[model samples]
Target: MSGSALKPATELARGNSVRTPNESAEYRRAREQLLAEEIELRRHIERVAELRRALPPGGVVTKNYEFEGEGGKATLSDLFGNKQTLVIYSYMFGPAREQPCPMCTSFMGTWEGKLPDVEQRVAFVFVARSPIARLIAAKKARGWTQHRIYSDASGDYTRDYVSATDADAPGYNVFTRRDGSIRHFWAGEMGPSTADPGQDPRGAPDFDPLWTILDTTPEGRGKDWYPRLSY
Candidate 1:
C-alpha cells in the first residue's frame, strides 16, 4: 500500500493476462476474483508494516545482559556491533532440551541464506540457553555459517526476554541503540491466544517462508504437522 506506484489493486487484477490452455470461463472469473483478493492481501501486508514502523519507542532495556559467544564474553550492547539496531532470536535450545526445538530450528535454518542481505541493515544474533560449545556444535551440524550465535549461559537474558519460567519457547525481539540509549523495538507478538480455532499460534506475515510457501499450495500448513529435526 505504501511502497511504489499507487495503482488500483483491483484494476491491476482485472488487467491480469495470466491464462491457461483450455481454461473455462467460470475458472477465469473465479481466478480474477482470487487475484483481486491476493492484491488486496499484499496491500494489507504493507499497511501493517507501515503501522509497525510508526510505533512509538518501546521500553528501555534496563539490564546489560551477558552472553557467551565465539569471541568470549559479550553483552547486549556488544551484540549491536556497527549497526544501530539488533535483532535477537531467542531460540528454544535451552539446557533442558535434548535437542533444539524443531520449530525454532526450522525457522533459523531458513534465515541462513538471507543472513548476508539482512545483516546489511541490522545486527542479527541467535541466543540460546545452552552453553556456547553446545550451540556451536549445533550450528556446525546444521551448516549455519552466516548468522552470529551466542549462549545465554546465565539465563538472565532468556528469563527476561524469552520466557520467565521453564516452559521454554521461541521468541523474536528487536532492540535499537539510538542517541546513546538502548531500547526495545518490535517483536513477533502473535501467540496461542491470538490463533484462530484449529490453527497454530503464528506471527502475521509469517517469519518463516516455509509456511508462506506452503500457504500457496493445495495442501496448506496443516494444524497438526510441524517441522522435525529429522524425518
Candidate 2:
C-alpha cells in the first residue's frame, strides 16, 4: 500500500498498551514518539525493497567466470543450481592473507544458521580469492556445515564484481538466470565514498545483526572496535 493511503504512524503508535514498571510520563511520551519514527522507518524500508524488486533487467553476464567449489570446477552459471536467482558473497579471504577478514567471518557466521531457510528461495554461496583447499579449511575450522564455499582462484570474478584490483573485500552480489540468459541483478554498492560522517559504510537495512543488537544498548557500535577471528 502507498504511504498516502495508510494511517499516520503517530496515530497508530498512540494505540499501544505497552507499559513498564516505574516508568515516568516523560519516558513514555518519548518512547511513543520514537515508536512513531520507527514505524515510519519500517515503511521507508518497505518502499525501498519495492523499488529494488521493480528494477528492469540488469546487464547480461557474458563472461563465463570459473570457480573451484567443494565438488569440483564450476562456472558462474553452475552456481545457480536449480534456482532462478543466485546470491554470492565475495569473502575477504585472499591468498596473501594468513586469515580471512574477521568482519567477513562474523557476517557469514550470522548467515550460517539461516542458510537453510534462505536457500529455499535462492541459491546462496560464498566465494573467495583463495584456493579451494584453504576456503574449505576455514569453513571446517569454523564448524560451518551448510555454507557452500567456493574459490575464485583466478580472480576473474573477484576483479569484475568485488574489486577491480582483486583486493580482499567483502561483496554481496545477486544474479538471475532467466530464459537461458544470466544477468547481474543487484549488488551492495555502498562503500567509503557513500559513508556518512563519523560512521562506517554499511549496507542498507544493515545485513549484520550484531550491530543491530548492539544499537539497542547504551554502548552501541562504537568506533575502534571490530570482530576478531577468536577471543
Pick the TM-score winner: 2
Steric overlap count per candidate: 0, 0
Residue-wise C-alpha lDDT for candidate 2, range 76-157, written one tens digit per residue: 9999999999999998899999999999999999998899999999999999998999999999999999999999999999
- Per-candidate TM equals 0.95, 0.98
lDDT of 1 by residue, 155-220 (tens): 888788778884578889999999999999898878998999978888888889999999999899
Model 2 ranges with Cα > 4 A deviation = none
What's the lDDT for all of these models? 0.90, 0.94
Query: What's the distance in Å from true for residue 81, model 2?
Result: 0.8
